[model samples]
Target: MSATLGCFFLSMWLMRRRETVYGWFAVMSVAWWICGYNQVATSPWPFRSTDGWEIANTVSLLVYSASFTVFILRFCDGR
Candidate 1:
């Protein structure tokens, strides 16, 4: 959890610097926090299954992949 918070703040700082990659960092941090919240302590009152965390983790991966793909394309195109 602390690690996630650290990354989240780092990403925020990067975003403040206007780094495009930090957009993905921010998205992944949010997803990571959602996933991590499921395991650290008591479950929230509404959630019954771990499915939501799994989905959040999966979404994080997808966002990462999509961002990498876009970054690569832009780099190759000199954009």
Candidate 2:
């Protein structure tokens, strides 16, 4: 669902590049999807150690948080 929403938002952004909120939302959604998938997946391939996986998860979380915050700020400010 998150990935779908991300693609939707990405398409929306592509349609209107001036509306950066949509771009940010797309980024946030994709990051959230990554985080969610990491949680559900049994193994984190391409990463040998748990530490690497943890780092990737943390980075995704940070991206989600930052993009969400920016999206909220831009969205609210536009109104």
Candidate 3:
């Protein structure tokens, strides 16, 4: 996760040079991922499953989905 976040921030920093909306979206995604991941960690699950990891996983998924959605929208707009 740290590596992933690190790469994303690196990309964002690069984007800052070009100054695209992707840079802002990256910031938003990172913020949401961090906040949601923490919430997931404190959540309770009843059964023993790899899915026992809820908070971080859910947050990660949502962040991925949101990022993908943005990518799609940008692609559709011929970005």
Q: Compare the candidates by lDDT and give the number of the best one.
A: 2
Q: Write the per-residue lDDT of candidate 2 for residues 1-79, one digit (tens) a residue.
A: 9999999999999999999999999999999998998868788677998889999999999999999999999999853
Off by over 4 Å in 3: 1-9, 12-52
Runs in model 2 lying further than 4 Å from the true structure = none
Q: Per-residue lDDT for 64 in model 3? A: 64
In model 1, what lDDT does residue 34 have?
53
Order of the predicted models by lDDT, top scorer first: 2, 3, 1
Query: Candidates 1 and 3: which is better by TM-score?
Result: 1
**lDDT score for residue 15 of model 1:** 56
lDDT of 1 by residue, 1-34 (tens): 5456548756675757655555544554655555
TM-score of 3: 0.39
Q: Least accurate stretch of 10 residues (summed lDDT) in model 1?
A: 19-28
Would you estimate the TM-scores of all the predictions?
0.43, 0.93, 0.39
- RMSD in angstroms between candidate 3 and the native structure over all alpha carbons: 7.3
Better of 1 and 2 by TM-score: 2
- Where does candidate 3 have its weakest 10-residue lDDT segment? 41-50
